[model samples]
Target: MIDAHIHLDQYDQTGIKEMINKWSENGIAGVVAVSTNLKSSYDILKLKQEYPNFIRAAIGHHPEEPPPNTRDLYELIDLVHQERKQLAGIGEIGLPTYKKEELYTKYSEEQFIDVLETFLRVAKKENLPVSLHAVHEEAKKALISLKKLKVELAHFHWLKASASTVNEIVSSGYFVSVTPEVCYRERDQLLVKQIPLEQLLIETDGPWQHGGPFSERQTTPLLLKEITTCLANILHIRYNELLEIICHNTKQLW
Candidate 1:
């Protein structure tokens, strides 16, 4: 199994080795270590070099942060282009949801749109899949931009969209990934039920924190077993069947 989205760069050297051992023990085949900035992109690439078989890099600037300077953005694009073949995709990119209150004031929504457009264009040009972060209304707008740019192979990670919007995303053939929240969050559980099997993928979204029973648990790929089990129950499929579909979906993305 593959963790379709995670910020592996956030983990330290010791944590990385521990994660690798856990993945091996848990039967996780690989992870898409998505990035949030130029430095993160570079770090994930280096990690990929060390564990080529277990890690795949997804390079992009996260929208929640202030937009990068022109020079920094240019450098990031150049680096991503140079390492395109080594990447699983361009991602951890999208418009900020209203929940990111500081971002709305610190970085204008217009500025956020511009940055997202740049990433969308880059993803389109490179013919790589994207791991998106847009949620709620932001998810709707990101979908619009993707369609406008004719960007294919998009995975909206931990997506929170209206039922109609989810239907639209699935109809358009884009993928949506669920996180551990699906085990307890009603919205995430509904999302799993609503999305088609072929379009469904699972992620940990680690090392981001979460609530519910997982409140005190360490967020790691090892938890995917429980997540997939929850999803299997929701989708009325066996654990192995759902896992096979999700694994195939991740392969289709790359």
Candidate 2:
């Protein structure tokens, strides 16, 4: 099994190493350590250097942060391009939650759109897929922009939106990853029903969004089995079959 999205950089250094050892013990193949900021991108790169066979890095600024001005956008593009092949993809990037009062005050809608557009441009230039964090109307807009860029295999994790929107994303041939929270969240179950099996993937979004058989206290790649089990039930398929489909979808990104 492969945990398509994880924050190995966010875990304690020793603990993360142990987690990778455990993943090997449990037959997990690899993990993609995604960046939420420039620093995290470097951290992921360092981890990849140490465990090149088991970990892949992705570089990009998270959309929840304050919007970048034109100069800052260019700088971010340069940084992502510099690490393009060393990294698996460009991501953890997309629109911010408009309803969040703090994010709203930090960045206006127009500013957020501008920053997202910049990210899209970089993804296209580097010919890399992106992992998006979009929900509701924001999800719709992000999909539209990504479609225009002709980026295949984009992953949208923990998506919260209408079935029609999900259908649009699936039809676009993009992938959507289900997190462990799906084991308990009804909305996530509905999302599972909406997405086709071939276009679906599983993720932990770990060190955060914790749940399932592993200690509820902390999330790790070890808990990915719980997510895969839940996904098996939702898709009405055997566990191994679900794993095979998700693993294949993840590989398409690289």
Candidate 3:
């Protein structure tokens, strides 16, 4: 199975090395390591090099925190271009929603859009897929920008939007990923029923904990085994069947 989104750079190097060693044994084929800043982008690239066959690198700046000075943001864009061949895509980038008011007051909405647009433009020019973080109304705004830029390969990671917005994203032929929350949340299960298997992907959003049995546990891709089982049960399909399809979807994206 492929873990389509994870922040491997956020983990300790020793832990990551151990994780890599067990990739084959754990039934993990590949992982898309996404970055949240320029430094993280560099770290992801290095990890990809360290485990070329198991990790795909996606470099970008996340939107939740106050963004770096505009100059630094563009420098990361330049980094994307410079390392295009070694990179899998541009991602973990989008407008903020959960922290919207605070971020908007800090960076201003226009400034945030400017940063998002720069990444979108770079993604378009590079012909790379983008892993997005927009939710609610911000998801709508992101769709507009993607349509405006004519970006075909986009992944909306851990997305939560209205039915109409989801239809728009599906019809546009973009991808949306679900997390382990689908194992427990009604909202996420509803999304599984609504989206087609071809357009759907599975992720752990690991290193970021969730509730229930996962509350006190350390997040890891190994948890995907249970997630896949739960998703297959929800979709009323066999486990291996769903696993194959999810892996295919990941390959199609990156």
TM-score of each: 0.96, 0.92, 0.97
Per-residue alpha-carbon lDDT of model 1 for 1-254, expressed as tens digits? Answer: 99999999887777688769878787999999999998888889999999998988899999878888889889988987899889889988998775479876666888888888898888888888999998898889998999999998899999999999998899999999999999999989888878889998899999888789899998888888989999888878999988999999998896
TM-score of 1: 0.96
Give a tens-digit lDDT track for model 3, residues 186-230. 999997787888999988888899787778877888888888998
lDDT on C-alpha atoms for all candidate structures:
0.88, 0.80, 0.88
Clash totals for all candidate models: 0, 0, 0
lDDT of 3 at 25: 85
Sort by lDDT, top down from the best: 3, 1, 2
- Model 1 segments beyond 4 Å from truth? 98-100
Candidate 3 total steric clashes:
0
Candidate 2 lowest-lDDT run of ten: 209-218
Q: What is the C-alpha RMSD of each candidate to the true structure, in Å?
A: 1.2, 2.0, 1.1
Residue 168 lDDT in model 3? 95
Give the candidates in order of TM-score, highest first: 3, 1, 2
* TM-score of candidate 2 relative to the true fold: 0.92
